[model samples]
Each structure stands twice: as C-alpha cells, then as structure tokens.
Target: MTKKKQNIIFLLVVLLFTVVLIFIPTGFENPSLHKNTERVKAVITAVNNSDLQNHGIVTTGTQNLKINILAGMHKGDTISATNVLMGQKRIDKIFAIGDKVLAIVKTDNQKILTARAEDYYRISIEWILLAVFALFLIGFAGITGFKALLSFIFTALTLWKILLPLILKGFSPIVSAFAIIVLCTTVIIILINGFSKKGLVALVGSISGVGITCCLALLFAHFFRIPGTVQDFSETLLYVGYTHLDLPSIFIACIFIAAAGAVMDVAMDISAAQNEIIDHNPSITTKALIRSGFNVAYPVIGTMTTTLLFAYSGSFMFVFMVFMAKGTPLNIIVNTNYVAAEILRTLVGSFGLVLVAPITAIVGGFIYVRNY
Candidate 1:
C-alpha cells in the first residue's frame, strides 16, 4: 500500500484502541436507573384525551394510535400517545393516527413500555441523515473523506467518553483540556496529512497557538477578575460533586481548545502556501519562503480574528439586547462578569489567531526548505 494508505490504517487502529481503552472503564453501557422508575417499551395509544397527558404534545390530535410495543415486558402492549401541537410553528414534527412510537409507562418505581413507534421513527431519521452526510463526504473527497470521518468520530467519542468524565472526576481542568487537545490534534492532523514535515509543522504551529491563547486567557482572566461561574451549567456541575473543579481555569483552557481549530487552519494554510512556493521555486531562500508564509498569514489574520470576534459576539447578542432594553449603564455592562468573560474569551482567541501566523511561518519555512 501507499504511504498515505498505511498512515490511514495506522491511525484507525490507534483511534479504535484509544476509544475502547478510555471509555470501557466508565461503564458507559449501562443506562441510569432512577428510583421508582424503570424504562419499558410502550406504544402510543391516543393523544390529549385524558388528564394524564394534558402537558403532552398532541401528535395525532386525539386519534387512536395503531402502533404496538415491540420489546421488553410490554412487548405486545398497545397504547396511544398524543401528538400535541407545539404551536411555536417552527417545529416540523407532526404525528399521525397510525404512527408507531415508544411510550414511557411511569409505574410507581418502574416504567413499563407503551409505544415504540416514535423512537424507531427518530432512529430511522438519524440513520438517514448519517447516510446522506457519509455519502456526501465520500463523493467529495474519497479516501480523505473517509479519514476525516474517522477523525471526527474519534474526536467526538474522546470528548464524550474521556474528557468530560475526567473533568467531572475533579481532575485539573487545564490539564485535562490540554491532554485532550494534544490527543485530538495528533489524531486529526495525522489522519488528514500523515506523519510528514507538513503535519509536524501544523502540529507545532497549532500547539504554539494553543499555548499562547492559554497564557493570554489566564492573564486576562485574572486581570478581569471574571469568575468561573460565568459559564452556564458550571454551577450545575458543582452541585453534582465536581466542586473541586476550577471553573476559571477550565474556562481559560476552553478558550484555547475552541481556538485550536482556527489556529490549525491558519497553520495548514501557511504550510501549504509555503510548500507550493518551494515546490514551484525549489531554490528559493529560506528567508524568502518564510516571508511568503508571513504574507499568507497576514490576510489570514485579518479574516480569522474577525471570525473569532463574530463567533463570540453572536452568542451574546441576546445578552447585549437585554442590556440595551434595560438601559443598563455602560459601566455596569462592562463590569458584569459574564460580559467580561466573553471579552476575555474573544481577545484571547484573537491573540491565538494573531500568533498562529508567526509560528506557522517559522515552522513552515523550516519544513519547506528542509523537505523540498
């Protein structure tokens, strides 16, 4: 097999091994068991006909359901679930009279199954969407697409199965974020570019970018005195026994991790630009090639810093609107920890974007001159 194919196979093996080793110990297979409640397979019978379901969505407007439960203790039970109109008008799901669905039967402590149609229908839809995306990727990029898909899956599974758990276990949030970032960077870059000078340049550039962002995040986080609780769901986490987790540090870490992708893009762009210059003019001096990288990075910096700014600002549009409506004073708005946190996030990420150019230029210059 060719070098690229070999590298792809090796990455797949490593990804599979990492996932199995990291997730299996977490007992992710078992569903949570709640007191006085057990999940059962149930089918929908009717919609909105009784007080028991006044709060339920009317799927079929009180029509009788024809779907039957297909599994568990209620394998053959037939029930009706309502297709309530959500009235928000944006919701597209409209349940029909004969649609099969899984219904949750709330027993005093154990749930019996009622309907299975909705669950099956949702699963079918999910599969269909997955198939469409897979086909699109395969059609567009072929083997590269396949490798990208694997890398995407591995990154997702790693975050879900390993990183979150580690954070919840009271591990240092910065340490966990860095560790996950390293793992993700390695897998994603190698899967896409293989183990070559180009990949090494991208890795080095991305890491340097992340490190710069992390430091900026820390310094500004302290300067702004933004509390970690500015993050939504952070308090929820603390209530769940992760009180030891430092929210501010985690927030800082997340700034870098979030910017990592953009930084990698900048790195790869410069690296590729430098590579093409070398390939076309193999005798170009290293200094001249480095200047070429700087030229590419300059335009990239302008666009990407704005990209990060808008991305961060978009999330706070509602908050800004609320402050405006309330006629909140500028000082108050600026002093709010939540607003300050976002400011830090934006500036820190922008700093990373700014730093990526120099790092990538240097690394790409060396790689281009040495490799080509």
Candidate 2:
C-alpha cells in the first residue's frame, strides 16, 4: 500500500480504538460518595462569611452561599450551600458572591435538600484553553500537528481507561504499566512519524529505555528504602478499601512511566537524525551512520539528562521547602522517605534516558543503513 494510504488507514483504526476505549467501563465507583447526589453548575448569588476566620493563606470555618443552579433539572432554583474551609491552605477554598461553582445537591422527591460547593466551575475555561491550544497547534504544523494532538488524546485515554482501571482491578501494576506504556509509545511514534523503519527504531529504543528504568527502580527503590506510601493518596487508597493494592510495585511502574517520555524523545531524536543521514547519503555505511547518530545524541542526551533533574526537582520543591523550613539536617532530609523516593526517581529515569541514546543510535544504525 502507498505510504499515505497506509497512514490514513492506520489513523482510522486508531481513532476507532480510542472511541471504544472511551466507553469502556472502569468498573469502579465511589458508592458512598455519589449516593443520591447530583452536581449542577451554579452561580453564587450571595455569601455569608461571618462564620469564617482568615489567617493569611489559611482560612477556617465556613462560607454559607446562596447558589442558583444553572443547567440542571433544578435550573433557576436558588438554594443554600456550604463551603467549608479546614485551614488547609492547599485544599481549602473560600467561595464568594458572583463566583461559578459546582455544587453537589442532595434531592428527595425532586426537591433539593442540601448543597455543598465542591469546587470552582472551571470546566468551561478549561475547554477554552484546550480549544486555543488545538487551534494554535493545527495552525502551525497542519496535518502533523493534528496527528500530534491525536497522539496526545490517545495517551490520556490509555492512562485513564486502560492503566488506571487495570491497576484498580488488582492486576500486577508493574506489568500493566509497562504494557500500557509500550502500547502508548508505539502508537504515538507511529502516529507522529508514520509506520516505517524509523518509527520502529524509535519504538524499540524507547521500550528498551523504559525496561532499564523499571529494573533500576526496582533495585534502587529497595536499596534506598523508599516506601510506596511516599506517593500522595496511596494511604488514602488503602484506607478506602483497596488494601490489597501493591503500592511498591506501583511505585516502580511510576518510575518508568515518568521517564518514558524523555526516553521516547531521545529515541526519536536518534532515529530521525539517522534517517536524515541515510537519506542524504544512501551509500553511508552502518558504522558511519552509527557514529553520526551518536554525535547527534551527545548534546541531546546532555540536556535531556538535566531536564529530568529540573523536572523532578520542581515537582519535589514542596518537600524541599518543608524540610528547610523545619531546619532539618541535609542528611536527614535526603534520607526522608519521600525525598529518597524522588532521588531514586530522578536517578533511575536519567539512567534510562542516558541509555536510550546509545540504544537508539545502535538500532538506527542497523535499520537506516540496511536500506543502502
């Protein structure tokens, strides 16, 4: 089949697969939480903050709000709602008049009983941002940009539909994560680069890097005594009746998944560079192309290895602040469970990133030059 025809056919198949994934049931639900509760978009008509106390960033007590349901069975109905603040600056919010909110209302016999403000109504704004992004992407890169957007959607859906559900269903998290990541990487590369030798080269190299990262995470996480509970909400999940979830294995899966993007970047870099070299000099030997791939990879890997550091450090900055604020010793801080986990995350991920460069270069050498 023609290359363009092949790409079109593949795209249709993938689009169908994504549609199916969207409707597949996750098979898990919070029965206690959603019982008899319906959410509605509301505009706060009035607020009574007389019962609330403010201490700079931290606020305690409650905001009693009058909200008008916007688009539901109770549309045009104004109801009293409570917005509670627990003094946790991070998660607590104080609502005010004229603010759009999502209020979960309890109903009996088609009459609203009570409403609780869940969060700000940002879904509309979120869509606006996404629309702008999609326009700019397609405007700049045309078909390639559209394909990139499709790949992005595929990745998000795979994680939400496949990975999360499988793990929640008590599947082996490490294997589930790896299988999902590999499938994502393959589809993403194929979508962006087409189904060709270069795409295959990239996929192999990326999966190789992911494998290395997973193994290293398994080893070093154990060595560093990093606990899976270091991840946020892990304890909450266990307490919420997923007590059998393998937290440590999930942590290992997380390590590779985090690194997989950078690994793919490196692999694609080498594959694309090698592809260009082979295209320009079709007679180039495999040995010369390998060297060319390595040359391109040298600078790319250097920056990428550091990118992993900055990314992890930025994510872990809150932990750093907490330790420094408490005047914790550097030694004690580094040995802390969460801190150590971050360290293991960065190092193992970087190792995979570094390794993928050579792996991609070698793979590309054989794949690209074999055509000559």
Candidate 3:
C-alpha cells in the first residue's frame, strides 16, 4: 500500500487501541471492604451550632447540618448530617448553608445510620479545567496537538490500567517500568515524527539512554544504601498489605522513568537536526552529519541537565527550607536518605540527557546519511 494509506491505518489502530484501553478495568475498583459506605453529593440546607463547646485543652464541637442529597440512591431526600470538629483545622471543615459538599452515608440493614461531611464538591471544577486544557492543546497545535493529547491519554491509561495492575500482580517493577517506558517512547515519537528514519533514530537513542540510566540508578542506589521507603507513600504500601514488594527496585525503576522524558527530548532534538541537515545537503558525509548533530546537542544538554535539577528540587523546596531553618549542616542534609534519593534522581536523569545526545547523533548519522 501507499504511504498515505499506511498512515491512515496506523491512526485507526491507535484510536481502536485507545478506545479499548478506556473501558478495560484495572481490578482495583471497589477493593475496599466497606460495603455499607456510600459517597454522595449533598447541599447543606442549614447548619446548627448547638453542640459547639470547649473542653479544657481541646475544643470539641459538632455542626448539625441539614442536607439534601444531590446524587446516589437517596437523591432528592433531605437528611440530617453531622460535621464533627476535633479542634484540628487541617482535618476539620465547617459547612455553611447552601454549600455543596461530599458526604459519606453509612447504612446497615437497609436503614440509614449516619452521614458525615467529607469535603467540598470539586469534581465540576476539575472537569472544567480538563476541558480548558484539551481545548487549548488542540487549538494551538492543530492535528499534531490532537495526536499529542491522545498520546497523553494513552500514557496515563497504560500506567494506570496496565503498568500498575501488573506491578500489583507481583511483576518485577524494573522490568514492567522498562517495558512501559519503551512503549511510551515509541508511540510518542512515532506520533510526533511519523514512521520515518527520524523516529527510528530517536526511539533507538531514547531506549538506549533509558537503559543506561536504569542500570546506573540500580548501581548507585545499591551503593548509596538508600531504602525504597525514602519515597513518599512507599511505606504506606507495605502497611496496606503489599509487603511483598521490593521497594528499592521500585525506587530504582522510578529514577529512570522520571528521566525518560528528558532522554526522549534529547534524542528527538538530535534526530530532527540530523534530518534537516540531510534535507539541506543530500550529499553530506556521515561524519559531517554526526558533527552537526553534536553541535545541536551540546547547548541543549546544558539547559536540560539544569532542567532536571530544578524539576526534582522544586518539589522538596519546603523540606529544604525546614532543614535550613533548623540550622542543619549541608553535609548532613545531603547525606539524608530523602535528599540522597533526590540527588540520585536528578543526576541519573541528567546523565541520560547527556548520554542520549551522543547516542542519537551517532544513530542519526547512520540513518540519515545514506552514503555512509
């Protein structure tokens, strides 16, 4: 078949696969054993502060809230809900009349026992924000932007549906993560650059860089002696009955997965530059094209290395501030497990960025320069 026909077929296959993924269940639904609990949206009709009181060192209070259920089986029914305040501002919320909120209703033997206020109803706003993002993405980039959005959706579904479920099923985290990264890199690069020499070079370079980063992460993590529990919620996973997981392996997997995006970026940069060089001078030698790719990659590597540092450090800015406030020594802070983990993450990812340039340049030279 012709190239145009092949493109159309590829697009159709992608769309079909995406649709199927959308409906596939990840087996994590309704894993909660609490069958009597139901979450519903409700609007506060009235608030009664009759139970408000101070009890010695702590203030114990309850707000009697009249609410009309907006959803679920009891929709349109008005019920009495209790908002408990334990004097902790972080967990306590005071509901006002006419406010929409989420509530957990407990029922036993088909009789409603009680309802508790959970939080403010914010799903509407979340959907609105998502819509705005989709609109702007498609509006700006047109067809390519639409494909990028699809790739985003595909990546999310693959992670949430396939990757997470596989890990939960006791698959090796390192192997699973590597497979997902390769899949994502292939689809994303092909979507952006099409099924050409450019995409192939980028894919090869990206996978090679990711492989190197993964190996380095494992090596450094082992030598550094940082446990997987250094990551947030990692310990929680063990508490929740996933004690079989290898936390250190998972943490090592995350390091390279985080760096995969930057690796792909460097690969694409080199590939695109090489493609352009070949287009301009069809007779250019492989050596000359490789040098051109290096020239394009050097400046990009500088900013990308710092980009990884900033991206990783920005998340822990508050932690850094707290350490400084307590007059902690820089050596102590750097040696901490959490700090060391971030250091590994940033440096390993930067290494991927640095290495992907030369790898992509070499691959691009072989692919783009046909006379080599």
Give a tens-digit lDDT track for model 2, residues 288-341. 998898999999988999988999998888889988899999999888788888
Please report the candidate that would top lDDT against the real structure.
Answer: 2
lDDT of 1 by residue, 1-372 (tens): 788787968877966766685557654343444443434444444443332233344332232345466665557756544444433334424445455554544444335433223342455567799889988997899988987877777887788788878876778888888889888888888888887778888888998888888878878778888778888888998897777888888788788888888888888888878878888999998788888899999999989989888998898999999999999999999888898888788888888989988889988887768643
Query: Each model's C-alpha lDDT?
Result: 0.74, 0.90, 0.89
Model 2: weakest 10-residue lDDT segment is: 26-35
TM-scores of all predicted structures: 0.80, 0.96, 0.91
Model 2 stretches astray by more than 4 angstroms = 30-35, 54-58
- The full ranking of all candidates by lDDT, starting with the best, is 2, 3, 1
- Candidate 3, 169: how far from true, in Å? 1.1
Clash count for each candidate, listed in order shown: 36, 0, 0
Task: Give residue 172's lDDT in candidate 3 (0 to 100).
Answer: 99
Better of 1 and 2 by lDDT: 2
What is the C-alpha lDDT profile of model 3 across 1-372, one tens digit per residue? 876676667767777888999998999887564688779899999999889887675656998999999998888989999988889865778789989999899888757899988889998899899889999999999988888888888888898899889888889999999999999888888877778898899999999999999989988888999899999889999999999998899899899989998899889988988888888899999999999989999999989999999998899999999999999999999999999999999998898899989989988998887787
Which parts of model 1 have CA positions greater than 4 angstroms off?
1-6, 18-45, 49-76, 80-103, 106-127, 370-372
Error of 2 at 338 (Å): 0.6
Better of 1 and 3 by lDDT: 3
**How close is each model in CA RMSD to the real structure?**
5.2, 1.7, 2.6
- Model 3 poorest ten-residue lDDT run: 3-12
